[model samples]
Target: MFILDIFSLQQNIDFSLRSLTISLLLGTLLSLALKIHYQRFGMSLSNRVAFSKVFVFITLTTTLIISIVKSSIALSLGLVGALSIVRFRTPIKEPEELAYLFMCIAVGLGLGANQWLATIVATTIILIVTIRWKRSEDQSLFLSLDWEKSHNIDLDQLQNCLLKFICDCDLRRFDSRDEREEVIYYINIANSDNLLSLIQKLKTDFPQIGISFLDKTTIPGV
Candidate 1:
């Protein structure tokens, strides 16, 4: 009888573990869905990936903690302590990133509560709507031009040249030191090929000018 009881307990434990695993898997799927939907917008690719990975781990761990353990007081205290000490050092400049993080956490919680179907259905609808919204807008382009301090180029003339090539141009930032200025331009162009051709012309016209092109993937410091 004792052996039979032990076998029954083992089966119950296995069933519970299987349920938890399914929950975590559903959560991960929901997170991925959110990522795909957000990517259609002007979201930073690398930042999105990093946020997704972090949230997935966080949700999975939280689900495990809340499921297997059945102590409300301990859970409440742990949550308080966790929130009190948590700090994010890396600066998240975009507000959209924070929204995505919250969505990921919500899906995880939903799955942990054994609401896998709801999580999947809700995420799917959200992704569809986001993709539709992205289709309505044009993609944005960024161009950065860096030159040596010693170069004596006419900034006004350069700006004129860029204005002719792009639909709109703005001086986004300038890093100046020792009489040197690294000017960054945020341009809205109808086509990327036009921007490339413009850069080539600039290179040909001023071979001595230290000009560079950058995209969304380029980091500010690097």
Candidate 2:
């Protein structure tokens, strides 16, 4: 009897198909907007285009799931149980990517709960603030360094030297298995003179090292 009570379905509310359709359409549009904003204003060094492609799908799926479950208490409990068995193993490489994903989920949840006005207003405000903040931040450049393994470069020394000329350096990739080693970095250069100084210093200190600078427009489609 208790088990039956636990599994019993509630009298579903009079759900509105028209409202669901409207929420889905709005969610789709918002997702696309989020995707574009992320691709343009995001600071992550990963593949923004590929990462953001899931936004629309995630938003719609979330909205659909929430709309279906929200009408019944039993279904909501069932959802919790169903999700308990699911495991998301894909790692998020950057915090910014995770934040964007959360925003996508928020849009879905808000619209699903029929808070369309709040969702739209909040999302717009957040995007505007994010764009302004990102624009105000320092500019960064993609830098690639390659050298023979025989050069025996010290990474710590290289980074220490980098700090003298750049505001910050983030090492994105490193490979040292072959005779040739390579490193990728996102560096913040304050001015052209600092950039020139860094280049000349690298040439003098590590003559065998190869240096390359790639702008965002040129590399990995951003």
Candidate 3:
């Protein structure tokens, strides 16, 4: 009886199989593209692979959910309930990760809705633009630093050391709490190798400092 019902339902939905197949393919491709984009832009290395998995899973799940839930009220209430129960305790440290997550979700939704051509076209354009932006010299690198015994450091000397390696640098944020100062720098370098050298110098000069680096490919979350 159940198998017969399943067959009947499958026959009734005209594009069910097509939508599912396309959604899966698009979700996989889009997730890969977004991951490549994030890496190219030098996003934070920590939890990146895990985050990509989450992004892809969310995209796939949301796509199927949107496709199956037809009634507006049911969809709205179900979404609310589903979201309410979801507690993401892991705070996303980078804003760009949030953006990529959303983009993946959008691509999934588009594919689920049978907007295949649009999804492909839009994603290609975005990928191209991101690649070009990454190659440009105007992009800034984000640096996270934790200075131990903050009083031991001289801001002028640190700035001079950084300036020697980069063409332009700016302090984006500084937080001093619990005997540690967290400093973030936006630096424009002539090349990616130069950026790595600057980070190495920071470690060599101040062995006690904890340093992390990311680039412009970050996305913001709501």
Q: To one decimal, what is the Cα RMSD in angstroms of model 1 from the true structure?
A: 7.5
User: What lDDT is obtained when candidate 3 is compared to the true structure?
Assistant: 0.74
Q: In model 1, what are the clashing residue pairs, if there are any?
A: none
TM-score of each: 0.56, 0.65, 0.59
* lDDT tens per residue, model 3, 1-222: 999977776556444666687778887877777776665564354566666767677778767876665324445576889888988897767776877877888887787777789988998898888767766745467878887665578877888999988889899898888888888888877655576688789888988888887756653530
Candidate with better TM-score, 1 vs 3:
3
Note the Cα lDDT for every prediction shown: 0.67, 0.87, 0.74
Clash counts for all predictions? 0, 0, 4
lDDT of 1 at 76: 55
Pairs of colliding residues, candidate 2: none
Model 2 RMSD to the real structure?
Answer: 9.5
